[model samples]
Target chain A: MNDTRLIRVVDDDPELRRSLGWMLGGAGLAAELYTSAEQFLERDDLHRSGCVLVDVRMPHMDGLELQRRIRRRGSQLPVVVMSGHADVPTAVHAMEEGALSFLEKPFTKDELLGVLGRALQRADELVQREAAHRADLARIADLTPRELEVMRLVVGGELTKRIAQQLGISERTVDKHRERILAKTGAESWAGLTLLAARLELVSGQPVEALATA
Target chain B: MSTGRDQRQTEPGSVERTPAFPSDAFDHLVSQIDDVFWLYDCQRERVDYVSPAYDRVWGRSAARLLADPLDGLNNAVVAEHREEVRRAFLAGLESGRFEAKYRIRLPDGSERWIHDRGFPIRDPQGRVVHFAGVARDFTERKLTQDRLRESEAFLRATLDALPAHIAIVDPQGVILAVNRSWRQFAECNGLAAPDHAVGLNYLKVCDDAVGPDAAVAREVARGMRGVLDGSQSELMVSYPCDSPDERRWFELRVARFETNRCPLLVAIHLDVTARRRAEEQAVRQQAELAHVARVATIGEMAAGIAHELNQPLSAIANYAEGCLDRVGDDRRPRSDLVDALVHIRNLAQSSGAIIRRLRSAARKSEPRRSSICLNAAVRETVELVRYELETDGVVLEMQLADHLPVVQGDAVQIQQVLLNLLLNAQSAVRHREQPRLTIATRSGKNDVRVSVVDNGPGFGAVAPDRMFESFYSSKPDGLGLGLAISRSIVEAHGGSIWAERVDGCSFFHFTVPYSRPDIASGPPPGVSETGRRLGPAQHKEATA
Candidate 1:
């Protein structure tokens, strides 16, 4: 899987593109090439698990614009920018905008490859965290209707008996729902339940609105 | 009967030709030549016979010569040759078959040279009996030989006395002879004297003077050899001679002395040192004068040339800075950035070109020649000098012809010329309330014409002919060399330049030869280029 992680490179200059591609391949990484930001959009391999290499200055569209466009497309690929001539403020701005790194050109092959490797690792971690976070949120969404109501009330600082009144149920019934919430969330008490509800805010926020409508 | 007849004949023949006298035969032989001959009877030491021819040779008859027989012939010879002739004649008579040559004068105011020949006559018994001789006149041959000797001596003396160095070499390039002047010249030049110059090769001298340029040495050697080998005309080679001052010019002339296949050469050297020195001095002075003129012109128009560059340099610095700023923004307008870059490049090139022209002009460096559009140069100069022109209220206009061909010249020099004229025109119209300047350009078959016309106060009564003379300006601060130098620059480019005025406007007109000057033809008549004429209104208005 790590071998199949394809590094995407976007540079208008053919020499820089081939050179960067060779550098990535030499470092035991696969490289996919794109000439421009527009070309990258037309490419179907945007979901590839690798870093995006881009030049700061190019014809038609520059690196920063391409970075913005890639971000809007919500691709998980990390974008790296490079320039031949010095552009200090532009490099600073690109770095501030979640660019993996901004390299000045004539940058050594080792420096660029090192930056790309770190960027690819960061992308992999990001994709995994996003997948795990989505699965946890799906598990929290499977709570019973009454338990979801109590989970929201308990985290909203309402008493368990108050939460039972709001749902027209006994305090014992609310306490029993709290126990199931702690078990499902792997929390030990009400505090743990509240911590689990906060971590599963994606499911907690939506279910409270559904309980309110019911 | 014969005995009595013989007795009578023998008695008479004794006075005429006697058979009984053996000495008479020797006398007859001597008479055949104009010589004195004598025979002595060896046994008695007495004269046996003497010829009458001795009378004509010795200025005395044979009878008288015999009367004073033993006397030397000195008294009868020329006074100077008398004793010498006598001793020579006596010695010849003593020897067998003796000959003597001597001079004698006739009593008739004439001199004669005589060659006397004497022989001893022998008897049948082999005893010496008489001395016989002959004499011939040989004065003409001796006189001719003496005159030839004198002429050769005089020629040698004259060659030695010449001021110019001279030498004569044989066909084999051996220094056969040289004059005194050449010897002196060689000594002064640190070369061996002519006496030691003989038998030396000529190529060694050239190789010493000019460093090892083998081709020149070979060419000269071939020419020298040809001259020695029956060439009719002399060959001459000249080069710069060694001298601290510019005064030395050496001319080497080589000529053959024979018509057939023989190796003999006659080489002569002449020193033209003074003329060469004068030429060098004149060339140096001319260069200095040109430099002075360039400096003076630059000094007079320092403000103008500076102004020409300042504007472009300022523009370039601004555009480059602007480009850097625009490219720094996150909201960088791509089109504006590109435009700024283009502007920066254009300004840089333009400024570079302007600075190059200024440096070349200031340093008096050689001009860079190319085919230039005359109209463009004129327009460029006007814009460059516009500030001064406008300050004087001189409105500049152009009537440039379209599709004009290029002209050949240094563009920078032409621009300088146009700048000078434009500034002059501006200055001329400065006093007027409303000044107008017009620049017109047109092309002909092999030329392009440019004119700067101004209307304010015309040249009035000043003759157009003297306008180009140095220091012939009407203005208080005019350096009259402007038009003069301009015309010279134009003429150097192989074109015609002049100025003419109409009513109230003066037009400085000049032509530039075509880029390829070989194709140029004369301009058409009466149709002034730029299609401009001196209208009656211009002339009358300026005169008023």
Candidate 2:
């Protein structure tokens, strides 16, 4: 685990927070502790590459609420929910709210480290995906309006002839447009370009079909 | 008067001659009198002269009595008295004196009681010359005497039939009279007197009382003195007077009264053993029910309690794990590991305390009364339910008053009451968007008051006071014994419990009296040391 990748422990219990900090530090991961979800939410570095471990039962803002707020803020800081007992309903709720893992308290040091590792891995993946989507948006922004239309059709699995007919252009012109779309998006093949477009659709909040129509 | 005496001294044959001294005046006086004045000739065995009053008494003419001296005795006297009258008449002639009481049969068949007496009239030589007798009618006096005797007998019977040991005392504390029950009790207790110690100074007896009843007896004596001296109108005190064969209780009541302008005291000792037993039984049953309720409450909150206990255990695990992780790293400061170990120890101790509290609450033990700080008790009880409230997202605010006087009560029972109220509030606010509960303690004039206010739908159409009724439940799954048991426990602790709705909040309030400093060092008066020690044991036996 990268020492720079912080493990944020948010709980109402000060002792638990302190002990968790010590445990994470001993495991070669840097840790930051907050006594409550509200205190955790006050961090300006939520966009940093890290995961937050929050207690599900807190005073003001619970772990699930914090998770929702993080999502709303567009920060993919993976949330790891901790519950004092085997509270299945709350665990399920936290998981549904995009928690990376649900850890019941009195968890072993290995369990804590394992869950934190997974949460950090998830955070890294989300950051990479966000960067890739930003790169994709920029690459897509570079294309001409006509080439962009052809790229959408090609990614939609339309044949080159059908794409040329839909856009009222020649088959040769549609093929040329697809080649440039692939080169600008840095794709090695047509399938690769389609895969990139699918990933873009997932992160960009737009459906592939909608982007194809556009 | 001289002419009437001269006529009596004259010979029987010379009685018809008028005396020179004022014969008309004497005759007029004799005719006006109500007594039947008659002169009998003892030697001749005949009646010489009979006054006009004889006609009225015998219901015959005076001349007829002269013709037959024995006419009145034979005809006027009832058959039951005829022989006795004849014997008295003859004895009077022989002995020169006569006295007899007999009933006379009137012409209308009504019998009148008569007291007759005769005195001998002798000459100067001291020889008996004639028997002068006055047969005066005293029937009214005799009838009045009979009625008075009958009424007195009825009053005595009524007083004797009462169950209370009753004695009437004078204003000076002297026992004037005692009834049959009092006498019987005295006899059974081997009191020294045939009249059940009547005329004895009651105050002295109370003052001289020994053994376990001395204090109560002294108190009774003081109270009786208060009543008798008009400082108090009445006195009532209940004391235990257990016999060798059975436990007993008696209520002594002394009331002052006036009859015939003389003040008196009626001290009555009523047997109240059955009432005390019933009260003790109720208290025992309440304690038993409270124990059951406490167990049931713990059962209901098992999940929450487990979670509450789990918090500390979880913290301890985390701290221990952290310390272990640091123990291997040389770069980690020793102080950090030491701190983590300390946290682990503290957490372990806290969890143990929680378990201890839970065990004590769940265990069936005798209810013990002691002076307890209300704030401390409230905090301890709040610790048990804090997790449940927090888990349910209910906000709890405690406003405990500072320097609250200690209340006398059973800590477990009081805690049960607090727990019941808290749980009820928690359940009431379970469905609310933002549930809030506030528990506040305040010192009142004579008690410490605790109030639990909840911001849920206030006690809707049901009267607030009815909430304490047993089996009166608004919840579908409720047994409805929590508040009832709480009320009983509070009342047994010399407190009161009530509920009210104010300003859109449901408030449950209970007050436990402040422990009296004087009584704090000893058991309450009127209870013997053995009885005090045996109270819970007796209750347990009875329950078993």
Candidate 3:
């Protein structure tokens, strides 16, 4: 269990939530508990990367509804649905809604931990990706207006002379701006800068569209 | 009514003719004809001519007929009718002709009715006048009319004695007659009494009816027309008529009545409000009974529902099993052990909470009626029995209809019956191979039905009806009140319950009437003489 990972348990049954939280905590996993899906959805801690263990059948907002709201908010937090009763259709629907796992009641210790492990692992991966993406976005944001224009043309496969002509700037100035972009973005070569520009979605106009289709 | 007075507008000149015969011949003619012919002279101020037939009309001889005045007719008039006759007679004297009817006592100790008439003739100078008159014996006709009227009144009284409203309508939908009950009902409802409603087209009256049942009244109007025209011979429609103050129900029936002149429609409207209320009250009472049963059944299976809840509780226990091992083996952090301890503590608290919730919910249950989904009820009942079924090695299947109409019921009572059936199914299949129980629900035209079928030993020799008797039970521990009370609950909802065998399996089925605004079904059978709603007896007639 990673201390960095937080597992949230949401259920209408106070006992089930507390017990699940306890079991996860005992497994060395830091856990947050919510008595209902709405409580979990309203928490400021939603920004933290975590896995949610939600009961499928609840009073107003159910596990599936919570999952939908999380997804619609673009949180990308993984969910593992559990039901006290044997409701297969609801489980399948929960899975279809991008739940990490669907577990029936009386699941073994291995099964609960295994589901939590996988869900938390995915959440961690998404968090890491988001962190890297955020850094890339900042690097792209740091680019000057002229440097961004130079990077776009470069990724478009245009010659440096052609970029200078399109921008009505001297070829030497275009070359200088390209160097600055490469430095700021940590690209080791011309091809690396082009890849980074595409990776960060910094390419604009024709080249970005071309790269999307490609 | 017809007056039968033929001389109200007769010509005075025609009535002033001389007697058809001379004095002796006229006396013989009047005596022979059963009528009195007489002549009066104004100048004498007394009766100058009289027929011997006065004995038949006035019950007195001709000489005594005028012994008091021009005639003793005024003295012979019935006491109550004396002034009326006197006024008409005095008016007749000035109008040249008159006709009046009155009752008189005859000389033979019999009463006779007479219609007297007189005509006046003017002299050539149009100053002096002569008068002649006839007294006809109308006793026989009057007696017959009186008997007819008495019999009609007796028939009306008979109809009024019934608790139902009755009316006789003509072919044109005109209300020719109505019983006392109809008038009372109309007055109670702030409507016109029969006297005012008669001769008013019944169809129009129904069309003009106001209330929630106005549509039903309109339908009745249509049905009445059908009955009047011979298009339909009989019609009966039951509907609800809720007033601003209270709820009411009635069955409107239209049937043909063959009159001597022509066929008519007989409408009978019965107030079934009490019966309807009794039925609802019975359902509520049954719900209370069921609530008790549910608590009792929960007592019987407290271990089972607890077992179901324990599934998750046990999982927490299982997951915490490794915490001790990992903490001692130095393979897991101390935090893991703490989390396990916390989880165990939480599971303990939760188990208590679940028990508390279930116990209070079961113990404090009161009859709560509402529109409920059968699927939800099935699910709750299944939850209550699932663990027991598992322990009994039985597999359960649910076949629930989708988008089934919601029916008004006491959900707790319905669940009790379901739980009872499922438990019975489990027991029935306890020894069978691959024991399976299927619970299904479906919507019928006017009701919702639930069926529990099991691949189990059938009712070996006991008749189905025998199973519902109090204290009748095939199971060693069953009190037999389950099925009896179940049947009562179902019937109290205006539905029928039944049990049968299919493919060597036992099937128990019941239906509950669903409330719909458009059309309502007749009340369930076994109504008492008072027409008060009664509990289901036999439930022998199955509507499936």
TM-score winner among the candidates? 2
What is the per-residue lDDT of model 3 for residues B212-324, given as tens digits with 9 covering 90 to 100? 43555566777778877878777777665545577566667778979699998887878778876786676556667766766766787776675557655765665465564
lDDT digits (tens) for residues B171-214 of candidate 2: 77777888888777766755635456776777766766555555
Query: Which candidate comes out best when scored by lDDT?
Result: 2
Ten-residue region with minimum lDDT total, candidate 2 chain B: B531-540
The TM-score measured for candidate 3 stands at: 0.51
lDDT of 1 by residue, A59-165 (tens): 55788888888888887578888765466898899998889898766565567667977997898898798787666565566677666767777788888777778
If scored against the real structure, what TM-score would every candidate get? 0.42, 0.72, 0.51
Model 2 score (lDDT): 0.77
Q: Candidate 3 chain B: worst 10 consecutive residues by lDDT?
A: B535-544
Off by over 4 Å in 1: A1-214, B1-73, B76-83, B86-138, B169-175, B186-195, B199-236, B243-247, B254-266, B299-304, B323-544
Q: How many backbone clashes does candidate 1 have?
A: 13
Q: Which candidate number maximizes DockQ?
A: 2
What is residue A73's positional error in candidate 3, in angstroms? 56
Ranking the candidates on DockQ from highest down gives 2, 3, 1
Model 3 residue B27 CA deviation (Å) reads 9.5
